[model samples]
Target chain A: MTSETPIIVLVRPQLGENIGKCARAMLNFGLTELRMVAPRDGWPNPSAGPAAAGADSVLDQAKIYDTTAEAVADCSHVYATTVRLREDTKRVVTPEEAATEVFNQAGRSAFLFGREASGLDVQDVAMANAILTVPINPEFGSLNLAQAVILCAYEWSKTQSLSQPTLTEQLPPAPQQDLDGLIGHLEAMLEPKGYFLPDSRADATRRTLRNVLTKPGWNHLEVRTLRGVLSTLAKRDRK
Target chain B: MTSETPIIVLVRPQLGENIGKCARAMLNFGLTELRMVAPRDGWPNPSAGPAAAGADSVLDQAKIYDTTAEAVADCSHVYATTVRLREDTKRVVTPEEAATEVFNQAGRSAFLFGREASGLDVQDVAMANAILTVPINPEFGSLNLAQAVILCAYEWSKTQSLSQPTLTEQLPPAPQQDLDGLIGHLEAMLEPKGYFLPDSRADATRRTLRNVLTKPGWNHLEVRTLRGVLSTLAKRDRK
Candidate 1:
């Protein structure tokens, strides 16, 4: 197992059995860490143990989060498994490509898989740097949650040796928390200017802004510079 | 959806739900042809339809055979999925390599996956030209039948366009029936000469013979030539 292996984050998963299955799939490809965001059923469901099929350790160490933001706070690269047609600006990638990029880049990555039926919502997708979609038969594309997770895990395993220890001196992308702080600062400044006017379209506008901001994958230093710029711009308003 | 997609053959599969899951996995990757040999509960299993998760077309078109030999009789290139540790002479390849070769080679190919619990028997493995092994985590390698099938199907899908139609001129290896016929003929001739002595070791000896014979992948003409030679030698012995 590599240190940079992406963590699997299931957002609002419905069933304990499915969660257990996802863990089994991840372990099969050598992925260990699992995080869940607000599961419908509370953690430590007795049903999960029998379904894990001997991958108990993954479930045992799985960390629970109150929200997706908190789950991926430390993750520098976040990928959303999109189940719906989205016209967002986020770049869509196949599992194979996502694995390659994750291995080559220096960062802690997390792949967010939404609820089994509905998949990620607009807010959840807005947090991702890229959309990961599996190319399936257009006629019959019915990959279950575990199946989808396994494919991504398998692809990631294939590129396990791709990252060299000193391949890049550049810092990895800033963690999701830092990026959120930058976005939050910008939103606060823009909110008073009527940039998000019309309550009906405010959600869409915010999502678009997030899509654009997250696309840059700014490093920690760049994010700090941008924050400083925002603070300076805000200071002029007080003056 | 290429015509040369390898057929998935399950030999002596035990469960109906697993068969259905396999169908779903195969369809997700554009593989529609499914063959089964000696399913424990018999064909048209009632339980399979529900588990297919709307991949009914795949299950609806599945073909059944009484034996592994017949299941792959029309297939030109036979690949056996070995689940156990084997020190056999046959070449073992990863699913990716098998997919590449299958696409490049001009032949109807078949992949033989063994029973859910006990993978293909020695005799079944001997029937194959090569072995297919998934490179999984050594410690926690718990890939169920559907998981294994999906990984293979996923890998096979990756090389869908790798084969250009006009690349090979040499005829594809003769359909498996031709090879089996040749083996049958040679076996009959050698049976009277005490070639397979010691009843306890006969099965191993036969497997060795099959492994040697299948390795060559002789085309129709080559098989025909060998058959004629066997008949001629038999005639001389009778005289």
Candidate 2:
């Protein structure tokens, strides 16, 4: 279970309430390990105890430390969560990507969210191999600490697949007609230009073009871009 | 901005920490209103203070009610988050779809997630207009309540205009329209054979053909297959 569960660390948490909430988020995502560093309010703070809700077990058993380093000392992998982007950080990951890494860890991994107001100091962020950032609207991106934990926990939970899903949930969206139209346009323009002529050879050309576009998911913008390229090429052939 | 916020109602929340964390997730998404229904330990539990960390403001302002309906009384819409799919309840929605509703809401809406262990009873889900469920791996879909809040938050965040996303964040392209042309070509062939001409006027036939091919988000493979069909038809026509 330790392999799957990430050890959640709070470095210099200034509030008891935040710690309690973080613990709650941890429990929500199947993570039970809680570690704290230099909490402002002393452990067993009455505020934190009741705030933990059903996650009291995590709060009760939470391991406290004097520093971020000490709290994550036992962790094989550590991630620091922050909203601010830094110039020098090594691995910058979205919460989902970070969770993917945590899911892959061989031993105990720790996800650290800093204090309430100031957030994790740059020095503390450097302690972990990776930094996890939530993509928020830059205009109003002040994500609270517990919010960060919840996002992290949510991504982790998705990987676990805890509930049965309906048929729509199981299947991806069906493909549409726009793609075929564009390809047909390209082929129509190309057929007379010798791009694909022999009736049998046309099949191979069409398959090769299809293979190139279908591997990764595409959206309207990319489709437009590809159409532009094809139109340019087709025009050149006309010339 | 209660209008844009998703209401987080905890039903019989057993611990202060869990409630605090839930509050944390709400605030992160700019959701501040919280309602608790008969928390086992009590409202304004002291333990929640420290656990709330930076989200103390959310905890400080939390409201407590006697029932789920009371908690959602002021909201225009509500979605209950549940792990179990009860046999009797109807109107279930995936969390992603729920986020879409919250984003589109003309007024305030609430997304309710239940407590740990036993999820929201069927009666609770029946109270809401829709039931919100997350699609997990199924093998391990049991998500903690706070984690559910986080996932909702993440999906909502994606809709936010958070600067231009990196190229990698781009979704797959919808299939182009070349396939529709192929379908049209085939329909034309069938029309000559009286397959759809006499009984179906050509203009009416064309409309039905277009309707059959039109889909919301088609991808590259789909268009290619249509083109392949056209190619086969061309080969046969040549023979």
Interface RMSD of 2: 13.7
lDDT of the structure predicted as candidate 1? 0.82
- The best candidate by lDDT is 1
Candidate 1 - CAPRI tier?
incorrect
User: Model 1 off-target regions past 4 Å?
Assistant: A1-3, A83-85, A161-239, B1-3, B161-166, B237-239
User: What is the CA-based DockQ of model 2?
Assistant: 0.08
Cα deviation in Å at residue A202, candidate 1? 88
Lowest-sum lDDT 10-residue window in model 2 chain A: A230-239
The residue-by-residue lDDT of candidate 2 on B156-196, one tens digit each, is 76655434322323222232234335455666545544544
lDDT of each: 0.82, 0.65
Candidate 1: lDDT of A9?
Answer: 97
lDDT of 1 by residue, B1-239 (tens): 24488899999999999999999999989999999999999989998999999999999999999989999998888988864446655667777788888887887999999899988888888888878877777777788898889988988888874555646777778898999998888666556555566778878767766765686677787677556544543432121
TM-score of each: 0.81, 0.49
TM-score of chain B of each: 0.94, 0.63
